[model samples]
Target: MTRLLEILISLAIVAVLFTVVGFILPSSRHLEHSVETNRKMPIVFDTLNSVRRFKDWNPSVAGDPNIKLNLSGPESGVGAKISWDSEEKALGQGSWTISKSEPGKLIAYAIEDVDRGHDKSSEFTFTPTGKGGRNIQITQAYDVNYGMNLLGRYSGLYVTSNIGEKMKLGLASLSNMLATIPNLDYTVLGKDDPALAPKLADRAGENLLVLNAAVPLNQITIQTQMKTNIEWIKKNIAANGLEAVGPVRIITNEYGSSIYSFDVAQQVRKAGTDATVKLEGLKLANNVELLYNEPGKTAVVAFKGHMSNLQNVRDALRAWAMTRGYETIDRPYEAWKNGIDPGFAPGQEGEYDVVWAIK
Candidate 1:
């Protein structure tokens, strides 16, 4: 009887120790990882704000090649969500929804994982660093609430080795992906009006009268050359019984500091016919050529400025396309919206739809 009493006493002591240790453990977990890059704030913020490019930079996707992803809600900012299903036991099924977004500042996501059940959240905070804020530091933080779940509190002990490590890997992958995008800031293109933002568009195939010109980069010289080319295009349109159907397009070949070489083109159609009908017989000048541009996808942005600033706009447009994983397939061109009448004089404003063909 004495031995039996001793065994019961030992069991009571063990239960007490287990309960005390469980209650003593913290009921919450917080983990953070940070990475710094020279990439601008806009680029980093935009990347985190949207889930469209999530697979590209997400380290978890690389672990499971057959993982299926479904995206819902708006395209970006708050309300965007991405859910994943994987055959791998570690991944199982989970969903991430954007809970909050502050432009150039912070992005927070509500994370749900079926395998790991706990109220979890993750956020990315941006801070400008380096001299003159040329570089940005991105901090990815994670939080989980265990509450009264002792089992969850025990799991929290390994959170650093598991969730913490994933955050580190993710941040590194994000920095690498940011490096692939062009560094030029495209947001400036739409500073005054949102409509001027770079957008995906389609260009219809059309017959064009193209005149190639190479002249000194002087504003007066370039204007004179454009005038001569436009006159030739007009005469060809008249001689061939065709009508000018659209604004003039200038396809930039090269814009060197000393010389500017470009192709001056005008879309044309047979007289009294829509642009859909192909011109069968057209007279072309010796210096001009007839070329057909095929219909394709393009990134377009509107600009009202002098011609000298067009290069920067083009670069910005290309950068925007690159951020979306689009590849430039053809040389960029400009559709002069107000016609080519405005001479290339200083302070002369010209309206144009800058275009870059992409796929």
Candidate 2:
């Protein structure tokens, strides 16, 4: 009886010590992780916001397939919810509901990990590279709320490393998934403020098949001019039996008297040294010319939409360069990207990278 009484007293003392220790432990934790990806901002934002695709990139869900999820509400955006029930200890039972959303900028969620029936919150921010406009900085932050209990505080202490690893894996999965999609679109991913963007870099030299045209800017719009140039190049590329490799590049040879000189060109796969012009439609017969673009320092900004929206992009780039003590030289140009589709139509948006030569 004395021995039994002594053992019971010892266990009670140890429990008391644990309760005291809880007072010194932190009551909450915050974990943040970030990754850089070449995937466009809209695609990344849309993918991350969809609860139905959670298992594809979410670490906790991916770890345990036995977890059954009940995704209810709208397909995406605010009000979407994904609740899970799992026998596996790792997954447990939980739910996530979208609390806030900003299409291409941010998405915030309220997380309820019901394994212990508590609530937390998470946020994701998609910012431009500050260097490369073609890429984005994807960041996720977790604000963990630990209950005011001895056991809760103890568990929070061990969560940091495990959560970080999962975040890294989840980001990798997201990058891979976006890369596999056939045709992805790009919208402006950075802040409208250009002062925070990166410095202009050097552009490389390239040989191109160009169709130069000087048109009265007042008589026609930028869209009409670019479309006419693009159609001509497409026909010429087809006639030559060659494939265009990259964006359709345009160089403004001169800008005066409301007249703009445009050299619309494409870098194509060749048979040997060069390609001979053979296009015979739209009054462009025997008008094909080849030009080798000299490499120079340039700044790039992504424009998402029609060519008419190009002035805004040019203005932004000029502002960014002026703040950095740079001057525009020669003229600006654009390289059409395979943004949504390789083709265009009325009101259809696409990604076009505007390049400006600077000194």
Candidate 3:
């Protein structure tokens, strides 16, 4: 009887100790820290715009060089996501998406943290701290149930020590990226224009092309094999008086040529019914052809080069055309200048062109 009483008393003492320890440990939800740093507003905003560029500054990226990551969307500026997988538990699985953006002000993100036995949504704010300067604040907060509260507390300690150091490094790297982007006096092009309205034509030219059953318009569409962002092309086309005519369609000719046929009919209805015209391939060699015809009084200048280096040639052609009183009427074409299988490296010689019409 005496031994049994002593055992009961020991059990009560152990229970009391457990309760005290539980009371002392704080809840996981309360264990978070915020990190902030200041940078140029423009630079900060641009760096946070895209998660793909984070590889250049992310602390985890440096630790795991072999980690494989997949990125999606426009690569930058809102709705973009970056995800990665790793054998290292510390860097296992996670993804971040740009949740919000305000040009020069701020960009916030939502983070899905997996592999840490938790989920988190974090926000990074880019606030204008001074004239042309920005203050960036990043807060990582999460919810943890009672069972995992201890783990969360431990994470807080490491975050202030290691994670804090890495995050600061990332911010510094972003600062450098911003420094490289030159600030021009000009504003972003076409900020006031209607989203889809074509600019008014300043110069009048008949330049009409018609398609019939015998000879269809050789609508050609060639995309850069390296996944080109055709934004510049879109802006150029809109900036000029060139208007679209119809539903965009990709057609393959019997000759194994691919053509992107835009409904010029739709464009004609708006610009003028009689403005449609056509041209024939006056010259063809190695799959590169020259389509020339007098659609109107306007002059058309066209050339071809590699897809990767097409921008350079196009720029040069634009300068040449402008000097000679010409403007672009179409989003230029790649005429297969190098042939079906050209032996050249990427950014090497390929079938591309810069075509323009002169007044």
The prediction achieving the highest TM-score against the true structure is: 1
Which residue runs of candidate 1 sit more than 4 Å off their true CA positions?
1-23, 211-221, 256-261, 277-296, 324-328, 341-343
Clash list (residue pairs), candidate 1: none
Which digits, one per residue and each the tens of the lDDT, describe model 1 over residues 1-359? Answer: 99999999999998888778879988998988999989877788888888877888766555788999999998789999989999988888888899999998899999888534377999999999999999999999999998888778878888899888888888888999898777878999998899788999987888889999999988888878888899998999888888888789899999998999999999899888778665666768758888887888999999998888899889889878766657787789999988665636565789999999998
Q: Give the distance in Å from residue 228's predicted Cα in candidate 2 to where it truly belongs.
A: 25
Compared with the true structure, model 2 gives a TM-score of: 0.50
Candidate 2 lDDT trough over 10 residues, lowest sum: 275-284
lDDT winner between candidates 1 and 3: 1
lDDT of each: 0.86, 0.69, 0.44
Preferred candidate (TM-score higher): 1 or 3: 1
TM-score of each: 0.82, 0.50, 0.43
User: For candidate 1, what is the TM-score?
Assistant: 0.82
* Best-to-worst TM-score order: 1, 2, 3
For every candidate in turn, the CA RMSD to the true structure comes to 3.9, 14.7, 16.5
Model 2 error, position 209 (Å) = 38
Candidate 2 ranges with C-alpha deviation above 4 Å: 1-9, 64-66, 114-117, 182-359
